[model samples]
Target: MALIAIFILRKRNSDSGDRQSSNQNPQGLFSILNLEGKLVYDEIVRATNDFDAENCIGNGGHGSVYRAELPSGEVVAVKKFHSPLSCDQIADQKEFLTEVKALTETRHRNIVKFYGFCSHARHSFLVYEFLERGSLAAILSSDAAAQELDWSQRMNAIKGVADALSYLHHDCFPPIVHRDISSKNLLLDLEYEAHVADFGIAKFLMPDSSNWTEFAGTYGYVAPELAYTMKITEKCDVYSFGVLVLEVIKGKHPRDFLSSISSSSLNTDIELDEMLDPRLPAPSRSVQEKLISIMEVAFSCLNKSPESRPTMKIVSQQLRT
Candidate 1:
């Protein structure tokens, strides 16, 4: 009986040690939250009133969005996803694990910061730092915001997105591909710095992974090659980023122009000004040179043959120049 009591005490001690070590480790987000700070789940519930319908910001292919505030009086955006268990079990696990894994491990200025997540039998949600300006899509969609998005802001924002993508594709150990790179996924802070979001979730969402049931992207942003080919590669993201860059400068998606250039009948070489968004004036000499190079790189990324497209590292270098 004494021996049994000793064994139970030992087990309890071991369990307590494990818990204490976990809290001390500079990993598993206990460290990060200590640095930039953490938004407690209970406080967030109060801020958004438990994600009341009135607080909803937007809806997406997989989830609904809500705006919440932190104890520090800072606002944030949270995405609450519908249980994929109702539709596809495999996808639910992959997407939840993918975003959670990617954000937990990676951190950069251009990358969106993941505060934390909550997953239970009834609720699944991700918390992210809020951008006062909201998505690039919303800004461009509004007449006032589009008008205010001047050339300088536009150029910087483009570089911000490029830098973020480059980090994901080259800087990371295994590299990450942001399967979704549309305007909606690019959010800007008050200073107009762009942070890429909605990354690391794509393949699993496709029913036929080998050959996607469909292109699995916003209509205009989907790479042209996806029309005939089903294979997904990092270049697909490069292609999408290229379109996104042009869209930022042009104040809209560039589907018509992409189609025109792709047509066998039309000459690929066209005046850059011809495609400029009318809202913005012609680029300055330096800006013009930069825009020309960017457009060329965009063209290369949009190449129908995925092999022909330059890797994002190369694209990042070109943008820096």
Candidate 2:
């Protein structure tokens, strides 16, 4: 690991610059390796223009993300967080550490690559490999972008996310539960391939611990069980994944549709074609049959009882078949 110490006398002229820089800790520590740490740091700082609003691409619960191009002509996503040394920023720091920890422990093709991170007294930021297509939510929200994501591409996205979740839940030494999994957290590359991002609230499913914690997930994406019990498990992520798959199939959130299907009074024999996004043409027969199977797996993940949800490994294998 490359450790570089630098002084941050100047801060971004933004709303996050409320606290004054202190002289006691003249130099802030930057943890990144082998990529010319100081030079990369300087390039990122200059490229972002002190994290100007124009460079910002998106805002999330944790921090604002900026798009930056290094001198090497490499484009990257820089997530500039609120100050970490301040009292009010304690929670932000914990979340930042959580992301760093989670990303460092696991790696997969369908997971965003963490290039480096800076934990400065005046400012904190994480660098990630930039994806051209942006978030799944953003693309699905746009008619043109959604149309570009055809039936095959959509299926690939779902499979990619499932593969990543399987790696996290089963492959890792101490299995991880992504407390937050939503369309917004799933990014898409140029080919519309899904890459899971944002691990601010991820927790390790330590066998000894009950893993009980406060609710931490996107409103509609969170599992229903979280509302009644804080005890978190891998199943919470499964439920969120189920919702995401439905969102990918249908062009929007499936809240009303899911509720209607849950009721025995409503007709349950909904056609697979009817559930697909209307912006694109109907899929081929083979694709339609595969989609039907995928839909079945997704609905099973949404089972009210957490124990009934299939393990991510099973979901991944089924999708592959």
Candidate 3:
């Protein structure tokens, strides 16, 4: 299998060299993927055993993520798109390009690093710096892993994500709406620090516009009002971030809890302890205060009214202090 991958990758590289010699820019679709060297692409193909299922670490709506270790001893996550461009729709192609653009253009500690990307004839994939701890959803789902994530770590993860979202919604020019913000999209490192990933559905908020578009987000994490409005806004990501905060603190999906609290009556009656995850012991006094503050901000973000939801920048600023 390894030898076969190498031969295939080498042939692909030779073919690419020939194409580059003939037409460097083929209809604006083919260009060097932000990095010099076709060797990186060849190495990645070899690293993943030609993207075999055994190398796959995770899968999402549009692609499967595989763990690849380069010859330099650095490991990376390779997301291989599944038939993303086969469709005639320009939007789908834009989404793919959007992800590449979003990652390449932005730089933040809480945002995943973009090594490079590949838009080859055989396969298309994006390479990202690997996070050892994997997705927060996977960690929180496992009792053993969840136990290792203490209150402080969980709190930091929430804050990290907030900062990242703030950078996207406020710091980035034209502003980027994640469109999809869920536990599955929040990756954790060895320290349990959160890094926002997956920008395939991200949209740029145009000036003097609502940036309205079709619904494109996870079920539970998507903002409630999006169903009626179908308008993509920064608030959509805000609502999803709120759900993530609760999920991290609670150590599980907060679907039932959210449902119960959606009614104004239950909102006031619900105790902090009741909403907290019972799997772990209650947070200490100092931690409790921060958690309380986080919960308050979270509820505000979850406001059914998009206008009522605080911007991610506000959320980030509050969490920082």
Candidate 4:
């Protein structure tokens, strides 16, 4: 597990004295939410040049991501929320913050390290450890990068995501359901290690509360059951993980293959070699067997019936073996 350094910015009351306290920094820009960390609010604004377009690295449904390099020479990814948010967007921001607070209590190696968040009147955003390699989707889109991510690395990436999901589903107190698990949400570090990111729609499965909600998650990766049922479960993530595994193996989205498999009742006569990405050379016999095993696990996870899909814990254990 990685060490979490949590920092939060709170609006100081107008009546409050300007004098800095032990908990507040000299600027009084941020307060310690949990653990230790001094995330100077001004530093981020300057680092991102007031969220200039040149600093922007990625864009998502919720907000844009910017790369901010602090004065200390530390690089981090900043997700700046769109200001003047609509009523529904405000609700989503609240849920996003709540989820971040819960995640700070638990840390996993395969999960992205969240430094903290800011909620100033001017701008609002979340900070996370930056990965040089970027998202899995970006890498697969490039032929050179895809070839660099060989079979061994791809397998490890799949396992890392599974382990992270397992921890989130079974280890967390209330158990978090990562509503979105597409390749775009999976990031890779310099060493090709996978880290799960983007919790914009994540939900906690509280035992006594209803888990039903409006439809969420990426289109193709979303569980088929979600289209008809508003209720959410960990199985949704498992199904997305199945799609991700196939995507990583194929070096692209497996939309056609997935459609064919679902229609053909998961034809067992398909050749494993034919299914693999052609960009790389053929794997050895031992590697092929492992790939076959992984594909089997992915297929099981993609079962049409949510009840038939295996839990992330089970999927993680299967990948480990």
Candidate 5:
């Protein structure tokens, strides 16, 4: 019901307030439905100790995320934007609003849950469900954590992302394009289930509108065509998903593997064993076959030509099979 109310508000304000200036003091512009604006705001500030460093959980290009536990014992992640909008902060305001718009529209099990957002003159932030295991990048960086993420868990993570992307690209009206789909944007729960997070640079592909936009995405996961085309498409996400797949399998960013592939020098006969993460033992026979199939689908997604890349729908279907 809150999501539905937010959607209605977004539609009503689409033409005007959606692009409102960040410098303006728009007091009590809380977009959350069914929650008292001032009450939730007070709870968040009190819980986070006024966004102190001790409460901080994660930091990103857009803002820092803090762990907040309300008086009701509900835990949430709060992404607070840096104050005093100037130059880059102005752009960050746009990104912040973009994320609010995108997340408010999306609803999927594999996608991070969006609770609400607050836009006050003093501080602005977005609230989301707290995920226990943090990010895939953090997990892969730790040997102990990487070992804990067994082959079966990794497979589920990959499929969850594919399913989320498929829903974003096809199931949503005006199909959303998540320009950034790097491992850092993928969060895991206690069960190792993957959830897609971060939509600071996401775009909605509206019909009869040019989807051209500035280049944005993690360097290693960015699509090759973006340098020249300057266009946003679902294929950009597909390419990033390819990189994520290999990263999950290799236990780190596959920079060298990506380079070889880009140079067209990658050996087709390269053994799968060499690509797997060394921290974990080999997967079972059935799981290995699934991994092989997944790798094939990933490679197809990373094709130099955007048109040649498989749609997320196709990739999701392939993974399911």
Candidate 6:
């Protein structure tokens, strides 16, 4: 149902060569994705053992992803659209072009690195930098992983995610709306540094128009404004980030709190230590104060009014200390 709310907001948006989607259909007419014969199709097949089950890493609405280690010893992630996705030829072609255009135009430390892709008649796949630590969702799910995720580490991850969105919203030529920002989409490196991935074919908003389509995002993390608005804005991501920040510190989803907070009748004040993840020791006073301030920013992001949310720039600045 929460994912359904994000639906009111999502609009449209995929692969290319040296890179492309690992599908068999021809991607439609976006010039950037027209690498045609240049994508590394052979390597992807060899790396995934012909799409064997062993290499499969994760699956989602867009496609099934695999963690493939190529012959060059470089580990990369490959996302292949399922055979059943009902996209028209033109849309598929455009998705491919969108991926090429966006990634080629933007460069930032927090954004995921696109390695290349293959758009084919038999299989289509997107090659992206592989992150060993996996998605933020994976870590928060495991007892061992959650235990090691401390206060400082959690803040670092927040900053990384902020930086990625900042680049997408401010540095791109026309700017890009990720349309998808949740724990599942945020991958982590060996040191657990956040690397915002899954941008092969993200949606973009016009100068002043709200782009609408079926909603896209994980449950409990989507913005409430998206529940009724088709206009995608950076504020949508801001709301999701607030949820992520709370999820990281609490060691769980903040759905219950969201439910309670939305009611607006209960007292809102609470001790910081009481809400933090019990897996780790309570933070020092300085960190605790900072966390409190950060939480304020997070809550502000949750405002029902989209315009009330802070920009990624403001969010990143608040986390720097």
Tens-digit lDDT string for candidate 3 (1-321)? 011233234334544856322221222323335455533667888999989999999988778999999888889999988753543535545566678767866899999987776666567788898999999889988888988998989989999999999999899987888888898999999978789999998887878666778878898998888768887888888989989898988888889878876544227445789768787887888888898899989988888888888998999899988
- Give the count of colliding residue pairs in each prediction: 0, 0, 0, 0, 0, 25
Q: Which stretches in model 1 have alpha-carbon errors above 4 Å? A: 1-37, 84-90, 200-215, 263-267
Cα-based lDDT for every prediction: 0.72, 0.81, 0.79, 0.81, 0.83, 0.71
Tens digit per residue, CA lDDT, model 1, 133-223: 8899999999889888888888888888888877777777555666789999899999999998875464322232343434577778887
**Candidate structures ordered by TM-score, highest first:** 5, 2, 4, 3, 6, 1
The TM-score measured for candidate 4 stands at 0.87
Candidate 3: where is the Cα deviation over 4 Å? 1-34, 87-92, 208-210, 262-266
Better of 1 and 6 by TM-score: 6
Off by over 4 Å in 5: 1-39, 84-88, 262-267
Candidate 6 lDDT by residue in tens digits, 50-86: 8888999998755689988877787888887664223
TM-score of each: 0.80, 0.88, 0.87, 0.87, 0.89, 0.82
* Candidate 6: residue 177 Cα off by (Å): 1.6
Total backbone collisions, model 6? 25
Per-residue error (Å), model 2, residue 309: 1.0
lDDT of 5 by residue, 224-321 (tens): 98888988999999999999999999999989988877345334556899789999997889888888888888888888888889999999999998
Predicted candidate 2 versus true structure: per-residue lDDT over 136-198, tens digit per residue: 889989999999999999999999999999999999967889888889999999888889999
Best by TM-score: 5
RMSD of 4: 6.7
Error of 6 at 142 (Å): 0.3
